[model samples]
Target: MATEALAVRQAVPGDFAGWLPLWHGYNEFYGRAGDSAPPASLTEATWERFFDGMEPMEALVAELEGRLVGLAHIIFHRNTGLVGPTCYLQDLFAAPEIRGRGIGRALIEGVYARARAAGARRVYWHTHESNAVAQRLYDGVAERSGFIVYRQDL
Candidate 1:
């Protein structure tokens, strides 16, 4: 699928300047509302890892006129008991003003393409239940699995 106006591609180190805003916007949408600091060193390491072909983690970005408006982060992990490899879409965020303009769709489609290339049978992600707008988009692209995920901070 060709994204004409929205260019979707793997993120590079130099893209961090563009990514930072979109990333924060995404986190804010999740109700982590206030500014949260991500160490510069860790952010640099993430950008480096995405370009490191040896790593299973990957990231994609959507650019319009050389400005980033959206991004997607994907992680490949093996599932237990023959569940096979799964691609988890860790994050998907688009600038609020740019929402519904295909940037988000392009980001998702790019993740699907990457996951397919990696031999993944399925791709999955989660969103806050109250995020109806996002859920609408997600519903159009993929089915919501029946299981609910739980976690506890160790």
Candidate 2:
């Protein structure tokens, strides 16, 4: 499909039904699947955050032919080292069949645009080491930060 044919916009309340599967797919891609799925309460809370005016979290969706094809979630937060806020491209996913059709790029670019508008000095995200395909795209659009990630569940 032509890139021009795809529309990227802020997700609306009406988009919940369409966005659910895509959200699940994104979690699944990150190894959250079947019994490991996030509880409904957490998922619903995340969904609600997008519409909460006081929340810094936001969600964008890409639609083609009236059907949702991609989703991107971003969060704006304070950074001690920077004068402006930092924007984190938290989660991004394009439908499997439309993976290489520029959907992801559009979503990332959209996030960049939104970040800039929100006074964010930098926009960054990470992918699993195994996701070479996405890394290839990331490598083209943004430089690798050279910082490794560490995490611990409290």
Candidate 3:
């Protein structure tokens, strides 16, 4: 599908139904499905945060023919290394059936636009190293920071 035909915009409450499946798909891709899936409460809170004025999180969606096919979740936070807030693209996903149709790219560009509008100094996200297909797309739009990520469960 042509990128122009995709409408990337802020997600609204009415989008919940369509957005849920894509959100599940994203988690499943990261090995977070089945028994490991995130708690329903967590997902509910995440969705609510998007529309909460006090929250710094936002969600963008890509629609084609009135159906949501992609989603990008972003968070803006203060970074000690920078004077302005930095945007972290927390999650991004495109439906499996439309993986190569530029929906993901459009959603990413939408995040970039939101970051810029919010005065964020930078925008970044991480993907599993095994996701070479996504890496190919990431390579064309942004540079790798060469910084490995580490996490420890509390």
lDDT of 3 at 90: 91
Q: What are the lDDT figures for the candidates, one per model?
A: 0.83, 0.94, 0.94
Model 2, 41: alpha-carbon shift in Å?
A: 1.1
Ranking by TM-score: 2, 3, 1
Give a tens-digit lDDT track for model 2, residues 1-154.
7888898999999999999999999999888989999999999999999999999999999999899999999999999999999999999999998889999999999999999989998999999899999999999999998999999999
lDDT of 2 at 101: 94
What tens digits encode model 3's per-residue C-alpha lDDT throughout 42-91? 99999999999999999999999889999999999999999999999999
TM-score of each: 0.86, 0.97, 0.97
Q: Which has the higher lDDT value, candidate number 1 or candidate number 2?
A: 2
- TM-score for predicted model 1 compared with the true structure: 0.86
lDDT of 1: 0.83
Clashes of each: 0, 0, 0
Pick by lDDT: 1 or 3, better one: 3
